[model samples]
Target chain A: MPALVLNNISKRYGDVQALDGINLQIQDGEFCVIVGPSGSGKTTLLNIIAGFTKPDDGEVTVDGKPYNQLSPRDRNIGMVFQDIGLFSHLTVRKNISFGLEIKKSSKKDIDKRVEEIADRLKIRKLLDKKVRLLSGGEAQRVAIGRTLITNPSFFLFDEPLGNLDANLRVEMLTEIKRLHLHLKKTFIYVTHDQEQALSAASRVMIMKDGKALQKGPPREIYNNPIGKFVAEFFGVPSMNLIDGTIIPEEDGSLFQGAGLNVKVKGYSQSKKAEVTLGVRPTDVVVGNQITEDGFGTINSLELLGDKNQIYLTLEQEKSIIAVTSPEVRPELEERVKIKLKENRIFLFDRDQGGRLYP
Target chain B: MSERIKRKGKIPVNIIMLLPTNIIILFLIIIPTILVIWFSLVNFQPTFGINFWQSKFVFLDNYFKILMDDEFVKAVIRTVYISLICLGVEFTIGLLIASILTGNIHGKKILYPLLIIPIMIPPIVIGNNFWLIFSANGPVNQIISIILNTEFKASWFSHPKYAIIPIILSEIWHWYPLTFLILFSGLVNISTSEIRAAKILGATEWQLSWRIKFPKLKGIITIALVIRMMEALKVFDVVHLLTHGGPGTRTQTISFYLFKYGFKYSRISYVSAGAWIILFISLLGFSLALRSVLVERK
Candidate 1:
């Protein structure tokens, strides 16, 4: 059974359709991360499920119970905000025990539970300190501990790691993933950073303009994105999309545009006349000599330890990026042949931007 | 030698920049305070054919007289009573209004300014207006008469037992808005995420207020209370304008009592002693409050 299901969720804020007919389901004990750009209604959907916001039309079923009419407190969901909303007036211990105190738990039980949680989160030494005195990563652990002590059915994180520095963010991200594993509870995390989403999520949902565009395991979504947006939104440095048209030939087909011609061998039955050929930067082969596909002048190079990101301008001023071994260093303004691995190229319809060929 | 000269020149320039302010302080504050102290030590009655400097030196005599005087003692107690009542009522009502206003309510923009209208009016004008409203044939009596189904022409200003009621009411009406405005700003400044986190943690509305909102607002609450308490302790305008400290000094606050002695009776020495005592008490209270707030912050 799915732990949480959102059926036909829709919400509008004045002229903005914040969420439009969003349908989703998270299986029990699955780590589901909703990844989207800002204003994609990711946070709005979380708010609706947590009962902080009322959806215009939807049913939020949690563990086979209708939760739409319940208050946030009654919904049994815990959320850690991006701001790490720990009560600054309280000590770390107090902040963690707050939910239990609200429930009027026994003092002994609360104390024991708080100590257990503090030990689990490795913040026992900081328990007596004021929340404002804590470092960013420490405060983040305390925020998670606060929710953990409540023993809610689902843990929702709304960009909880957005405020941390890069090093601290990775540390906390690993800690959160470990926490989900140890708890064995369903976790619904939301973030705009695709790297975090890909690294931590067992299943990923990509949203855009208040719609869930794709949902699957991280690798499935990355390898077979349903549309151009998802394909570009997932990878760092993004996927390179070249505008072109497909012409059916005797053997297979030919994609011709932007001062280059490449044979599309496998997709012989593709009927789309106009298409956008998508390629990841790692798949673009660059060499000193001309290839059958195309050639371009190197604009810049960014070193990424073992690899280098090469920016190239194609024949008609169209730019494309390629990642290659650092050993393939070329001087700026040097013309290099570029070849797209035929099997790795993705063809998307020009108008609708939907995938036309895998 | 050049560096030393530059440092010396900078010191003089700083002093020169502060010279005008120091002179103004000397003339406006320091001189008057010294004069008041001097007057308090001497029996300076202008009613007599003697100037202030020529008055008889009676060290501590005016202070003793103030302590022994029943009217002064009663005025101090009345002032305390009025201040406590006003602070209590104003804080409770102001906090309630501020809390309600902080919610997602419509017309809040319009209502907020309207609520502040009473505070914008001069206290003397508010006193006069309230005096008219509590008059024998005014709207208050008219409403009471209708409610009671009789001609309830009870005189609020002259009744010996209840004469201070109208003074307290007018003071609250003229000042509660200040407390409300401060608290409302503080309440709104609390992060919505903190409130939401509390709710998601299963905090009830009351729990959210006392646990999250109230703790965050402690410093602001202290400031509002201190400001209102100080102003309330100096309650004079409404009492003087509405009741004139009587139907027999029934509403005589310390400020009104001092005003009467200094201006009406020309007992400058006695009033000065009383003023010093009140000032010392006020400073003591203010310091205690500030110390507690500072310590809590740490």
Candidate 2:
């Protein structure tokens, strides 16, 4: 059964539409992540789900019941805010026990639950210490513990690891994933970090300007993004986008862009418009000129740990990043050949940034 | 050697930048306090002494005489009584009014000015105006007449109990606005995210306010109370201008007592002692209150 569903939810602030016709359904106990850049309405969508906000139109349903009618206290959903938002004056023990105390649980039950969570989160020694004295990672764990003590059915984490140090963020991501697996609860997480979404979510929904641009498993979304925005948004050094025109090919099609000339494939639309080309950095190879298919030039090179990122200038002053092993890094100003894997090329409508054809 | 040069050049620049503020603080605050302490110890009459050291050594005689005086003791108790009553009324009303004002109500802009208008008037004006209202045949008697259909005209100033009540009311009215502003800012500054976190954790609104918001507001509450308490201790302007220590010394504050001795009776030595006593008591009470409120852990 679908654990949660958002049907055509729309929210507007003044003249700006924050969320426009969002429709989503998550299977029971599935971990779902909404990924986007800033101002993409991902947090607004999370707020609507958490009952912190109400959509101007349409409805949300959880377990086949209307969600908007339920008050936040009655929603029985746990939330970890991006700011950590631990009650600043409470001790760790008090913070974790607050939910139980609110439910009017027995003092013994509250103490036992608080102790159990504290020991699991490894904040047992710090239980009596005030929250203001806690380190960032410790405070974040306490915040998570406070939310989890409620035994919520659905969990909402709004960029919970956004404020942590890089190392701590990775550690927290692992812990959250472990918790999700142990509890088997439906989780709806929001983040602007594409890498975080790729690694943590069962499925990723890429949002752009208040609309879902693409939704799929991480591998599929990375390999076959449905729009120019989605294609350019994922992968480190992102997908290389260069401008070019589509010209008529011999048999019944048009060859789009200069980097890779091929007959249009798979697109069923009748319109044969000029479009831009997209290619991943890893899919494009950079080396000395050994073939004609490669766009050859030497522009700049960056050594990122194990692999070197080679920047090449193709025809029409267009630049592309190609990933190569450190041993293959050519001299700074030396000429080099850049090759494209034919099947990895993407084409997009130049006007609307919509995907055209492979 | 280069690092030494950088360090040397920075030190003088820092001191030079701080010179003006240091000079102002020295002259304005430090110098006056030192002079007050020095003046407390001697028989340095303005007509007799060429310098402070030239004065006769009184050797605690002034302190002894002031401590022994009966009226001085009464003044101290009256001052504290007025302050306690004022603090009670002001803090309760201030918290209630602040919470209401922060609510989503209509026409709050107009209400703010209406509430603040009383605080805007000068202290002397407030005292004099209330003096008229509380007079024997003034508003109080008129209200009594309307309520019971029989006129009762009792002199507010002539009755010691009645006089203290008016003083407390006037001070509460004068200063509750400050408390309201401080507490209102404190409430607004509380992160909404924290409240939401509490709610999602199943806390009701009452628990959210009591456990989360109230505890976070302690620092501001402490600061506001201390500022109000210290100012309330020096409750002189209203007492002096309105009652003039009248109705047989019932409403005499320590400041009025000081004025009557130092300037009115030309007993500068005795009033200097009274001034020191007032300062000592205020400092003691303020420090104790501050320690209990501001310095203690939760």
DockQ of each: 0.76, 0.65
How big is the positional error of residue B196 in model 2, measured in Å on the Cα after superposition?
1.9
Q: Tens-digit lDDT track for model 2 on A255-276?
A: 5454544444443445456777
Q: Per-residue lDDT tens digits of candidate 1, residues B231-255?
A: 9988999988988999998889999
Question: What C-alpha lDDT do the candidate models reach, one value each?
Answer: 0.92, 0.82
The reply for model 1, stretches above 4 Å from the true place, is A267-274, A303-305, A325-332, B1-24
Write down the RMSD of all candidates, one decimal each. Answer: 2.7, 4.6
Candidate number achieving the greatest DockQ relative to the actual structure = 1
lDDT of 2 by residue, B1-298 (tens): 4433236436666577889999999999899777656666677555444356676668688889889999999988888888878878888888888888877799899988887776688999989887888888789779988999987887777686677767777888888898888888898888878988998887787887788878888888878888888888788888886678877899998878888776776666667777888888778866886787656564
Clashing pairs in 1: none
- For model 2, the stretches where C-alpha displacement exceeds 4 angstroms are A252-272, A287-291, A302-308, A324-332, B1-58, B100-120, B128-159, B292-298
Docking class of 2: medium
- Show the lowest summed lDDT stretch of 10 residues, model 1 chain B: B1-10
